[model samples]
Target: MIERPIGRDVVARQRFARLFSLGDRRAPLSWSPGLVLGPDDPELPVSVAPLRSTRSYDSIPATITICPRDNLCYPFDSEDKWVAQEGLVLPPSLVASDSGMFGSGLEAVPVSWNSLHHDDSLAVLDSEPSVIILIDAPQLAQRPGMLAEALLTVRTRFPSSLIWAPGISGPDNCALLTWMGVDLFDLARLRHASSLGVLLTGSGPRKVEETVNEDFGMEAQCTTWVQAISSTRAAIREGTLRELV
Candidate 1:
């Protein structure tokens, strides 16, 4: 169970608090009463239990932030495939353009990614999200200007919901994200780098130093990653997520 930090007003912290509360209740996440998938949607198979399914409004705070396809593997029409691959479908109205799919209520919060390119359509995207997900697809992630534009939009409307920037692997990128006030981050690119024989080491877990494969053996990456996550959870518990970065 991960303990949550009290001060940050981001949805990630909310979800962590929910998970932590469940842990305190000694509740098995799988057995928790909550929406798993849509009533009619097919369930997918995966080792890691689905995140949204395990969340319960009754047990914890209701707001949730999600970048449905963080890796951008799904097509615009691949919503079902995306859910199936991820093990559970979320509320249908999130992806549906038509009305009455699922009326807006306390169901859940849906957040989407900003395509790395500063596409002109971003203005339209501004209406929906309480929070917008800004990805640091540095090499292939969204460019800086696009991120700035989106952040500007977010600052205008739903300033309460935060910008979650992922794939930040360096001090420069971290500095930029921090300056942007990015509330949440995940080490996905580091995992991608590891899969490609590139090693990530740095002052912060999210900040990558170099490809240090010689000193840190290939097999050790998994163990080191576990330790890193453990350390990160501990730091967050102690109110030092921002400090570590």
Candidate 2:
């Protein structure tokens, strides 16, 4: 097998959309892009938004970071309505609308295949997206080998595509994902854990003590956790994310 590239950073083009594949080999890929507002464009009234854990990721403004998910049809359907209402065009797709309807704004929805034998989505993404990120969810854990097979199948189908995975956090997890060539990841699970009173330190998870503090609530906790994730991203840029995790 050919070795995947390492220590590569992707630069997004002005009109490029970065796609992320979620779930197993049998599951289809789901992707979204990070949208940024142009300087000359009219700026909308900025909302002092509530926390994402409270208001949901879709309601939040497009920032330097992005978080996409696998089982997103449900959320996307509802979120797209707001997108239309807000008159915003998400990244990867050059669309402008008074209303945001998920999938409706895009020329096509991102799809996933069980393997190379079934990959029809690869062609569509290749025809577009300046860069594509492939992630191996299964490879992140030692619990299953089937995940690796599925990722391999996807890789074989899109060899020219730029992908990266496993993500930063765990040793075996990062190794497996990097080995498979997943370049980007969303760290929502860690945030979710923080919201649930779990603390992730250098040694891994430990429950937050009840006596830690009374003033910190869900939103505060999420903020704290997100800041840590931000630091992790910085580390990732420095090529030390895997080591920190």
Candidate 3:
């Protein structure tokens, strides 16, 4: 059972900012800006364990972290210390999928919108997962019509599940994706930008090499994103979220 409460009452034309309470002790995840934190163990509110991995820690309500077949972070191992210290326990969801695309042990059945026939695609939606990850997001990004169609299909079939699009975040598209009802995003692009020595300003990514050394770092980039998300959330609340896009 997904215990998380989505504040649909505040939704302005399918847009909303809500809180996801994991447990009584842990801080409830605030979606005043949607959850776009780092993809690290400490950053997540729910305890995540791969479905195929040995249980190193006691079972907690796990949000199956899905990854593509080629993703290096496959076979995610749970840290017993984090679970014990943080008390990040969650109820297990009934939804399950068999797609081998997940690198994490989480039972996320992958649904490739472009690869599967319409009937097969509809079958995947029957599980009604709390989160639906778009495995072929890059392809969807290239084809707006396909992305819209996929988002629409999922919204129609599973109105409640949060849509996640990995490897698709930056100053360029985060607000736009959130406007489209994407509830989750990976921090890969942020890390990539940091590695390239680029600073993410409101205008866009600027090469650090071209600017003064004092203003560039991962911390600065993360701060910028946090502000952007906060601003976007404010817009959503005011029903002006589309203006940011």
Candidate 4:
């Protein structure tokens, strides 16, 4: 899943957070450690899609697709080569462990990832894959200490898989999260800001009335996301991401 750059030694990687191409070596990444635009505005190079079937993979879109059905997520290779994911490490929380429609508690305040358990931690250490999605990242971020520890643990476990922490990042925290080794983000927070009648900026989300730029719409949020992502990419290359954060 990683396209190692020319200068990085394998051992040197452990000392610092990593940045690299996400998938398909034939296609080098333009900007990884970047955003995966939300469904509302997907102008960026990568955006998400969804899939489910009692049918064939022939009809699925050739992009990242989230499948909610159990043991049903099978995204084809960029060339439709039918490569399979070994397994997904799903962390279970007692408060919301009922197997529901969206894979667990779709609408619930989650407990800390640490409180979840040793079993899940063990699962992570024992498995290695191309991607690891912290589905409840927004909730986890509320506890900064726990969030950092969770990120470090995942990075140590699967250094190669770019961490995907959805719903937890925007211009406000993008650089910080990137410094923690999260390679992908979604505009869930920005979209929420738009819905709440605000323009999300690097400084933070702003009130529609307070800002001179009246365009507090989705496009405005996309522009903000772009700027944040560009800054993040630049910081990663320049080795100033911690300073940026």
The lDDT values for all models are: 0.32, 0.32, 0.47, 0.52
Clashes of 3: 5
| Model 3 regions more than 4 Å off | 1-28, 36-109, 115-127, 209-214
Can you rank all candidates by lDDT, best first?
4, 3, 1, 2
Q: Please, what are the lDDT tens digits per residue for candidate 3 over residues 1-245?
A: 21222222223443533222221223321342344343341233222111111123244323333321111121222211111111221111211333322222112333445323323444553345444566566667776487767666666775655566656766567678776666666556777777787777556787765445545566676666667766665676677767788
How do all the candidates rank in terms of TM-score, highest first? 4, 3, 2, 1
Winner on lDDT between 2 and 3 is 3
Going through the candidates in order, what is the number of backbone clashes in each?
A: 2, 15, 5, 0
Candidate 4 pairs with clashing backbones: none
lDDT of 4: 0.52
Among all windows of ten consecutive residues in candidate 1, which has the lowest summed lDDT? Answer: 79-88
Estimated TM-score for each candidate: 0.36, 0.38, 0.60, 0.65
Of candidate 2, the 10-residue stretch with the lowest lDDT total is 45-54
Candidate 1 lDDT at 245 equals 49
Badly placed stretches (over 4 Å) of model 1 are: 1-131, 135-144, 167-172, 203-245
**What's the TM for model 4?**
0.65
lDDT for residue 225 in candidate 4, whole number 0-100 = 79
lDDT of 4 by residue, 70-169 (tens): 1111222232111221122334334344322121111111223533343343343443443466655766676547677777876776666556777788
